[model samples]
Target chain A: MTGSAQPRQPEAGVRYDVFHTDCPARDVVDHVTSRWGVWVLISLRSNDLRFYELRESIQGISEKMLAQTLRALVQDGLVWREVEPATPPQVTYGLTEFGRDIGEPLTELFDRITQRLSPRNAG
Target chain B: MTGSAQPRQPEAGVRYDVFHTDCPARDVVDHVTSRWGVWVLISLRSNDLRFYELRESIQGISEKMLAQTLRALVQDGLVWREVEPATPPQVTYGLTEFGRDIGEPLTELFDRITQRLSPRNAG
Candidate 1:
């Protein structure tokens, strides 16, 4: 915030500004790039899911961590969190347009890195 | 390891195969996505440096963590570790071709995410 790095209001609706130290961008990076963040992005890549469904698919994430990661993603506008006023409170989580766009590239990167680093090459 | 998820052999130089769960890819992901891994990648974006130089650029990393992270990246073939046969044995680290290629896109993504999530728009 102290620096001259002004926030970018790209394309009217989208904004990206991380140069400043105090920007909320740092928080978003911390949340989205967190240990659970990468997995959450990959999990949500295929389809939408309810709270519990997401919890189950991610394998090792605790409910608290999942919820926290989701909330952070929502705040960053990278994820959509919908709440239905149905009988039992049915909620679904899915990727926003921005989040969806990131899927292909991120997935490709993940796939490549994982593939190249397989254990057999350790020797 | 039980499945037929054999590792890939590409270009007689590069390999990538991530469908398997037990592959070393998982370990690489764990290391690179660690709290410090992302920063280390970004730090290495600039140039090669001595061990201490890398340790200083990353701000809050402990010496142990830096060494560990570098070792992991080196093991994955994404980084090269050079040791000098001098009096005190000077060492330098730099990215491999694969690592360098990943920089542009990864840095672009990091910059965008960091910029967009700045706190001013958090409301």
Candidate 2:
């Protein structure tokens, strides 16, 4: 709750259609559904992580790419960044309420792939 | 069924970790979760369509992208193509069993976005 970025509040009666060519939600979907985005969101599902922890968990994301991804997610209001006041200034990243709402279905989709589709591939 | 592309069959005992850098499932996730891919899959959920029909239904997809997306989906065994014997050889595309299985959760996610998320944005 300290120095949190201002999240975008949905304007009343502003509907978006992802199927439409110009819908803003398309960008939202694209960001959350991006390969790196999915990995980052799901990795944070268990616990908030330091930047290095997120990098380690996702395996192959470049520092530049991870930073860019985090910036996009924070802008979308799906993830929040917290900077702790300290000698070195600790930082942690976690989902916002909106992030968790979208994360529910996203994680479910991820689970469908890993838990069912993948196991089916296994002998 | 004539002239349909050979779909990849999942081999038993071969596990895939989408979280891993090199897992084939990562490709699968990337494709299906793509902005256009999600629209294509969900469009076909109600009924199969011809190539042009798919392009028209997806709103802003260029012919190249729609064609390319279908080719990838068919190769992954998530979709199948049928060529009917006729003077012009009519063609149609539909989800295979695997496509439908994968599409189930994918559609659920789409619904979560369109039905729930979008409505929340509305006044």
> Each candidate's chain A: what TM-score?
0.75, 0.80
Tens digits of lDDT, candidate 1, A1-123: 333564543244333433233444556656666778777787889999899998886666789999988988888778899999999999899999767765655676676675445445533
| Candidate 2 total steric clashes | 4
Off by over 4 Å in 1: A1-24, A115-123, B1-23, B115-123
Which 10-residue span in candidate 2 chain A carries the lowest summed lDDT?
A: A1-10
Stretches of candidate 2 exceeding 4 Å from the true structure: A1-15, A116-123, B1-15, B115-123
Best by TM-score: 2
TM for candidate 2 is 0.79
Query: What DockQ results do all the predictions give, each relative to the true complex?
Result: 0.30, 0.29
Q: Can you write out model 2's per-residue Cα lDDT over A36-110, one digit (the tens) per residue?
A: 887888888889999989998887899999999899899888899999999888879999887777777777776
* lDDT (tens digit, per residue) of candidate 1 on B1-123: 344554543334232433234444655666666677666777788998899988877656789999888988888667899999999999999888767655555576576565344444433
What is the CAPRI rating of model 1's predicted complex?
acceptable
Q: Which model scores highest in lDDT?
A: 2
lDDT of 2 by residue, B14-92 (tens): 4466777667677777778775777788788889999888888788899999988888888777888999999888889
